[model samples]
Target: MKNNINIPKEKLNQAVSRGIEKGRQEKPMKIRNSSMIIKRVASVVVIGGISLGLTFPVVVQAFPNIESAIIDFVESVLPKSYSNKLKHESKKNNIVISDGKAIVTLENSTLDNYQFIANMIIESDFFKQYEESDLEHNLYANLEVSIGDNKNIVGWGAHIRKIDDNKASLVVTADVGDIKLEDNVDVYIKLQGLEIQSNEWKSNDIKELKGNWDFSFKTDKVESIKRINIKDEIELDGKTMTLESIEVTPLASYIKLTADENISDKWVFASYKIVDNNGKAYRNAQIDGHTDEKAWNFTIAIYDDLSNIESLKITPYTDEQSIPSKIHGQDIIKMTTTMDEGSEVEDIIVSRPVEKRDLNVDAKPAHKYEGEKISYNLNIDKEKKFYTIDELIGKSINTGDGTSVTIKDITVNDKNTTIMLKVNGDYNVLSQVVLFDEDMRDIYSGIYVTHKGKWPSNSHWNNAKDTHYASGLATFIIDKIDVNKKYKLAVPIQKEINLNSGHTMNINLK
Candidate 1:
């Protein structure tokens, strides 16, 4: 009506429909733009809130709880070995994580029942990993115990920590007994750390451990001991006795002996042939005592018949001696002798001297007598003593006459090389006679003369003229000469002899 124009109904309707469709599209665009702007603002707020939570101290503190809960859960679920490994790493790195804790204690109702006691504590962390790649951590405690009683019996107590797959910490304590011992004893331990997986968190952190121990006993039948060595002041009496070399057959039966050196001089020893129950003498063995410092040792051979020997008797050499000389055991016996007081031994002796004889010597010249015809006779006597001619002859001489004299002998005093000679009639009277070897060089001259024989009186002759010479009556004792060599004696006599009308000069050597 307003258009007043008959615009067709289809055209009007079409325009209206197109306009609605366009409005619908435009509305959706406006809604989309508004939604995007609202979404971006919400995202910024969410990011700011997360950042604030991280920076706040209260929020950080809250996180530790969560971490501790997670570590505890993991420790409860992990294996003990695995938990221990994580504990060690955390300690080395100075790291504190949420891990479970363990505590151990040792208790005694009566403190007097224990003799010695000790306490020990340890702290460690625990951790574990699961089959699904999950991890957990924990802590634990252990206790060790050692106890001794009046009966000389010992007891031990130990608590072990174990982590299971459920992340649970299992504590187990074991009490063991029947430890009967008379002396000291020791225990060895091996420890390691590791991680394992379970249902809850568990800590391998081993904390408070009680290692305190106690020992107590009454000093009842304990045998007192003293060491002794005996080496000197003892002797063995037998056909053949070895002092230190002898030994007892079964060594375990012999008890170590004891003595004091200050008192050892009073100790003595004696041995006897042991007799068996069968009346047969045991091996003729003997025992010797030896003392090294304050101890005594006895050496005895194995008795051939030890089984039959019944008893051995021992008595000190003196009642005042404090040392016990007799050691008695089954089938074995030892005896000690007594030292005599103020006993002394004498010194040794020496021998006397013998006398030697002196040698005798004599010398004389030739003589001439007047009668129908005269001859010289020289007599010599040795004064009943051992004498040599070289001791009387002195030396060699050379005269102006063309003659040389040498004294020599093929053998002298049983020696072949020594020679002795004398010349009376001389071409040249040799003032000095040189004794020589085969080479003719001088060997001995001064105080060495050549002659052969023995005289009764060298200083006093009974049957000789005023001028008488004996050339052959001298003897020589030679020393150190060769046996296979030959020698010669050369004598140069005067070419002429002067005789009176009825007198002739003669020279004789005897």
Candidate 2:
């Protein structure tokens, strides 16, 4: 939620100096949540890297250059675009703190406009009691951070793992609000508590540690955020949604779109799928977007480098089959280190990342919705056949293009309205669901869950039948819908195919 002005492309190549939490949420989350654990909208996000410092750090009289800054984390944890941005911002630090019982080190750190990661290692005799079997041990440390003279208290989240009986590694990430990296950036961390967790035993905790781990280090100021102005429009829920601008950086691209008529109130998360010219697809976990609701601006963070992208095929997708439910696969990561003789442990290799694309280009999506509509002109009166919400539960409506939906149930509560539906026929992706009032104001209902019908276990998208996964539950926020006013349920003639011809805009970066 830092200042976003959509700087003009001609005036942009300069460094972007603010700090942002690198996750897809409505805004940058502060670190005070359960110490440093940050939550993302699409997936659970944590920082990366490991650090070990046996002694207090001295100003590395000779600062380590970019090549030696443990840049491997960028390659491993981040998308290519993010790694590229953070790789330059990384600075090596060996700050150490100990309170007789345990020790922690701030080994390496990086900061840019989008986010920051602090690589740390904590060692204590206190952890020796927890024995490791075939299972892995994890130690989560609750830490808080602050940046520069602004005393901006940042939020943090950690990914911690026990490396040895007495040692553990952690990647601490957080959001430093409105701080400029060009200034003398000083970072302070207060180590609060440590939790020991594993499959076999109850978690144990060590509360409130003594001396803090405060460190100050400077990084190269070379963040290049590429801004491109675009004026492409796509129809969403019977309205024109404009793709206004896109700002690309190594960390992530900030894509701004304006929804017609200020959709701020009825907005659900913008679901967009991206395919590069290489046919490499990027979606789900790597993409996160939010709307500030002012001027109807929606900003999406696509964690990839799009500055010089020769061409792109981007679309607002609603099909469950199009977006991944969770992270799928990983790449082989090997970490090699050189050490002197007799050191307890000299090297560690930890791997984490993504997965496969497609069996073949000819493969079609498993479930996709055809252009369809729900009659918006119907009045909800008890005298009408499908007038009452409860009366419509067992009713079936055909979408004309070989798709139909049967309502299993509809739940109305104070918070939201939930409709359980069974989709019948070919159109498995049920288009965009909405609730329309007599005045024709559309309220988008979010489909939170989709249960695919039973099918062969290994069936890919190409061979999957429409009936394989035919039903889903979509919910709309129309708390206790006004009974006096007439409203109708609808599937707003959504297109699942990639926007083609006039609907899509091609950007040639040459």
Alpha carbon lDDT of residue 452, candidate 2?
34
- For candidate 2, list the clashing residue pairs, or say none: 20-114, 30-155, 31-155, 31-156, 36-156, 36-157, 81-250, 329-354, 453-468, 453-469
Cα lDDT tens digits for candidate 2, 1-510: 011122232221111101001110011234332222232232223444444221212211122221232343233344454334333324556566666777666666666554566666676766566532212233456666665543566655565544444656666666443245663356666666665444222234333334455555554433646667878887666667787866665455555566655443334344555567876544323222233323344445555445556876566654433222211121111111111223243222221111112112223332321221112222122222223565456666544234456666555544345454554433434533555555544443322222232211111221111111201222222233544455456542222444434435444444
Error of 2 at 377 (Å): 41
lDDT of 1 at 154: 21
Alpha-carbon error at 145 in model 2, in Å?
A: 3.8
The number of residue pairs in model 2 that clash at the backbone is 10
CA RMSD, predictions in order: 57.4, 23.0
TM-score of each: 0.13, 0.46
The CA-based lDDT of model 1 is what? 0.23
Predicted candidate 1 versus true structure: per-residue lDDT over 1-510, tens digit per residue: 001112243443344235334433000011111111221100100000000111123322433442343344223322222233233422111111122432211111111111111111222223222221121212222222233433222222221223222222222111112133343333211112223322121223332322322222221111212222222223322111122221122111111222332333333343222223443422221122434444343332221323334432121222221111211111111111111223232211111111110112112321111111111111111121211333223323221123222233323333212333333221222221222334332222121111222221121111010010111112222233343332222222222222121211111111
